[model samples]
Target: MIQTGQSIPEVVVQQITPKGIEKTDTVSLFGTGKTVLFAVPGAFTPTCSEQHLPGFVQHFDEFRRQGYDVACMAVNDPFVMQAWMKSAGVPDGMRMVADGNAELARALGLELDASAYGMGIRSKRFAMLIQDGAVKQLFVEAPGEFRVSTAEHMLEAIAG
Candidate 1:
């Protein structure tokens, strides 16, 4: 697991936009300014859809007010990410990034294998407060835990 004060890995991810598909690197994603990046194990999974992503979606405005560019990533294809965003009612503030081959997850050293649950090579559920492409704070969950490292928690961390 990558820690705070470490530079984020230079990993390229596929951005699925209504316009089309495009490639973007991690620096490109977080370079504009401070960014709040959260990763989930899988797209459309119960916890991700019902809680994790929705927490971010609901608190996106607050995150933006605190000067953070918000993004969500998963180890799934671009098309699936796009569809899941729609189904989950993702708001405009949150950008959905696709780590199609788990490259980004691997680069972050946050990759997880969930073969028993039928998910192969997925990202762990974690959130990081990154500034200028470097990690400022990291909140990673233990397997199946979702209380901390949430959008609300990250917001509080930013506030304090």
Candidate 2:
């Protein structure tokens, strides 16, 4: 996995917006300041829907107040990301990124092959604190494990 202090590779990821999905990249998203990026294996999956995403939405303000642009990413199409965002009630303060081709995830070395579990290549569940495009902290969950990447954990980490 890409380690702390490394600049995120340049890759195009999509962001779902009211107008439509738009292509965005790490430089545009995190180049100017701090960003809190969290990734899920898939959108609308149980854990992702019930916990992972909600945690970020719930803590979006705290993250912003702490000077972070929080975004949720998944290896899903922009349409799916849009629907999931609506269903998840993603706040305006938060953003959803579509790693449709897993490009960004692969660049971060956080891509996962879940063929045995019936899913194809996906982004591993993970989170990172990036400052001006460089990783400051990275928390990647072991397969099927959810820790370290939780919003509470990040909040606690940032608080201290």
Candidate number of the best TM-score: 2
Q: Name the runs in model 1 displaced over 4 angstroms.
A: none
Question: How many residue pairs collide in each prediction?
Answer: 0, 0
Stretches > 4 Å off in candidate 2:
none
Candidate 2 residue-wise lDDT, 42-153, digit = tens: 9989999999999998989889999888989999999999999999898885878999989998989999998888989999999988888899999999977999899998
- Estimated TM-score for each candidate: 0.96, 0.97
Model 1 over residues 23-124: C-alpha lDDT tens digits?
Answer: 989888886599999999989899999899999999999898888988999999999999998998887757899999999899889999988888888999
Clashing pairs in 1: none
Return the top candidate by lDDT: 2
In model 2, state the lDDT of residue 133.
89
